[model samples]
Target: MKINFQGAEIHYSIAGEGEATVMLHGFLESSEIWEEFLPEFSRYGKIITVDLPGHGRSGCLDEIHSMDLMAEVVLEVMKTTGVKKANFIGHSMGGYVGLAFLEKHPGMLQDFMLLNSTPQADSEEKKEIRDRSVELVKRNKPAYVTMAINNLLSPKNTGKFSEEIEILKERALKFPTRGITAALEGMKIRTNKTEVLKSFSGNKILVAGRQDPLVNIKELKQLAEESGCGFISFSGGHLSYIENKVQFIKLCISSKK
Candidate 1:
């Protein structure tokens, strides 16, 4: 269904009942990524899947120019859907959005599951990468974004699952250029949330790919270790959840219970 927020429409889906679980997809992806796994998760509790502004069916947002704005969009979704609190699961850029949400709206989340994402801000090199990405996107649409994402996974993952990777690439190609611009801009300017991680009070799980280059696995481990949160790993790269979804779902359900 569509929920009107700030003149833009956010599309979302709801399934089952019990404590709420919100599934947030990464940049250039939509709520549809959860289709294969949401059914299994629904057996555990209420599942809410949302299309963040500029992604999926949630079309063109007027004011969503930062990660903080993305978080506000999520809060707006929760309010519109009548979810007072929820357990949040986010991957990649979605994790950044989740962090922004937690920083701005603390009491609204019961617990969090960060999948293949980091709370650290961009380093100079990372900033340069994001800057180049912005220029590349402007010059050639989503080709750069898709190519960058493909590189985030292992060779085996891509070679064996070429079709899946191609599908994601195609879907990503449809992402609004302006929206991608907004998201990249957010990444460039976002502050480090390491302090926010320390302040987190709820049950948390940090899931990472053993080969993820975008997010340092050691840093992820340090965050989980320091925060006393559970840390789980898979054999793939940045898109570990998609590559190894069985373990991903297991971690999500197990963490909730």
Candidate 2:
């Protein structure tokens, strides 16, 4: 469904019932990425999945687009859906948004989960890569999406999760070139949320992949230690949820309780 917010339509999927639980997908992904385990999450409460602006079927804004803006878009979805407070589960860029949401709107989160994501800003090297991705997407869209998927998976998990990666690639290939540029720009300007995560004194969980290159286990361990949140590791790459849905849901359920 579309939630109208500040003249932008936010696309969201609502499933099951009871308390609310929101799921935010990573960059180049839509809420549909959670289809496989929506039923599982729904068993605990209503499961909400959202497509951040410039992704999936959501509309974009010409205003200052940042991770905080994305979180506000999500907040609007919650208000419109009558979800006073909900547990949040975020992946990659979505994790940044989750931290942003906590910083800006702490009262709305009952519990938060960071899955295969981190609070640190990209390094100078990583920032350069993001800049290049924007340029490449504008010049050759398919190659940009293809290369992105290639970099996201670890070599060992590549062959094992190739089919899942292809599914995500399809989602990326469908993105608007201009939207991808906007996303990269948003990523570049996002504030380093390490402090936000550290200062957040609330119920939270840290979930990491054993083989995730982007946010290594060491980084997640540090976050867990610094923030005093429970941490769990699964066997997979960055896309742990795709490869280990059972363990992911189990950890989420256990952490919240």
Candidate 3:
């Protein structure tokens, strides 16, 4: 269903019933990305899937949708749905927003998991890449999205998941230039929340992709260790939910147990 938040329409869906489990999709993706895992996850609890502002059916809130702002949007959804507290699973950019949420509303998180994501902020190099992405989005959003989705998957699995990749690209094409650039700017300025994860007294999990081009596996593993969170690795790229679905789901279930 859609809710008005700060003059923007936010889209979200909740299914099954039990403790709450919120799933936030990454950049360029909508709540639909979590569809395959919803049935299984819902069996455990009420699973919520949300379309972050500027993506999917959600409307943009501003020129830059900061992680803090996005987290507030998620909080609004939970409050509206009568969820006092919930476990959170975030993918890529979604994870960044989760960190922001953790910092802003620590008591609200029963547990948290980062899928193909990290707690670290963008490095100088990554920030430059994001800056470039903003420019690319303005010049050619389709090409930028295509290149991004292709690179997110391991080169070895690209052919295997070619159809899926195309579909993702199509979905990404729906993003307006303003939204795309806004996300890039927001991600570029996000603060490092490794300490937030470390101090969290609740259960946390970090699932890293060994072949992920976007994340530094070694760094993420170190962060997981330092934070005393469970660490799991998969032999795939950033899209481990698709590349290694079984193990991913198993880890998710086990994390909550």
Best candidate (score: lDDT) = 3
Taking the tens digit of each residue's C-alpha lDDT, what string does model 1 give over 1-257? 88888788888999989999888998778898888887789999999988888888787775236888888888888898789999999988888889999998889988888899988899999899888988898998867867876887877787877777788788778878888777788878888887786788998878999888778899899988887778888898888777897777777787556
Question: Each model's TM-score, in the order given?
Answer: 0.95, 0.94, 0.98
Provide the lDDT at 47 for model 3.
Answer: 95
* Model 2 pairs whose backbones collide: none
Error of 3 at 219 (Å): 0.9
Ranking by TM-score: 3, 1, 2
Model 1: CA > 4 A from native: 62-64
| Root-mean-square deviation of every model | 1.5, 1.6, 1.0
Better of 2 and 3 by TM-score: 3
| Candidate 3 per-residue lDDT over residues 142-200, each given as its tens digit | 88999889899988998998988898899989877788888889999999999999999
Query: Poorest 10 consecutive residues of model 2 by lDDT?
Result: 248-257
Clashes of each: 0, 0, 0
- Our model 3 lands, by Cα RMSD against the true structure, at 1.0
Comparing 1 with 2 on TM-score, the higher-scoring candidate is 1
Q: In model 2, where do residues sit more than 4 Å from their true spots?
A: 255-257
Arranged by lDDT, best first? 3, 1, 2
| Candidate 2: C-alpha lDDT | 0.83
Candidate no. 3 TM-score: 0.98
